[model samples]
Target: MKKTMLIIVLSVFALGCKPKQTVANTKLDNKTERLMKGDWLVSSVKYVGSDVFKVTSFNIADAKCFEESMWTLVSNNNTGEVVLNKANCATFESKITWYVNKDGNFVMKFLSEGIKAKHTTSGYVLKVANQTETSFQLIDKAAVGSNTAEIVFQFDKIGN
Candidate 1:
């Protein structure tokens, strides 16, 4: 009985002890520190339902359409921006919320630029049913009837 009681006490203590955070986790934190600043390109975007384009290929032709861009890395890889023109035109400068989902996914949101005009970007999450990739597809978060947008983002490492 005495030995059993001692084992129970030690077990309780062991259960209470928690592991320390390591240097690698710190590095990941640093990597995601900016989470929402810099330039990110769209690689693919799928609308929830009846959508027009998928943006499968990346190219200079697509770069021409960005006005501004931002990125986050906690999840798959979320990015948001405004497209003011096409064929390497110019991206409109606008502030948007870009991040991953609560369940470790990508997500994005675009605020209104005008009263009557629709916000062109929303949703910032990257993930599929059973696969994860280095890239993510931004699609409208709420299908139609929502002001939010869906977009695919390709991140260019800060130096590369």
Candidate 2:
């Protein structure tokens, strides 16, 4: 009878200790950090056409030169490295860092320009259009030669 009573009391205590809400509350910043932790691949690049309204998309697979390119994002310190896996392109890595700014836009900073010259000194400040466990979409408005265009970058998580 003593053992039974003790077990019943412990069970009641444990049950009461559990959080009232089944799902723990997660802050938006923390949630974004969690989702951003991974090795991502450039799935596609889309650009606004001459019409300035029409959009044209190009898949990485469609470009035979780029086969296994990947962007490894270090979640802890908002740092990362870009590897452009192509025979013609220089294999040397370029340092990269990224984070969500106060405005909620996703900003990427390149410490050094890679051999491929992915971005300019200004870097890229892109808005996160969508994000999920496996994929994310970033959009930016930038000058394309003589005209301003909308650039959409699509990335898919390849690894943790």
lDDT for every model? 0.40, 0.65
Residue-level lDDT tens digits of model 1 in 24-110: 111222233244344344433344444554332122223314313434333333334444434444434444444433344433455
Tens digits of lDDT, candidate 2, 5-105: 99999999999998876642222355675687878887766665643443321212223233346778777787788766666744545677777754557
Estimated TM-score for each candidate: 0.33, 0.58
Q: What's the CA RMSD for each of the models?
A: 12.8, 15.6
Off by over 4 Å in 1: 1-37, 43-85, 88-93, 113-152, 158-160
* Model 1: how far residue 40 lies from native, Å: 2.8
List where candidate 2 sits over 4 angstroms from the true fold.
1-28, 50-68, 86-92, 113-122, 145-147
What is the lDDT for 150 in model 2?
72
Reference-based lDDT, residue 93, model 2: 56
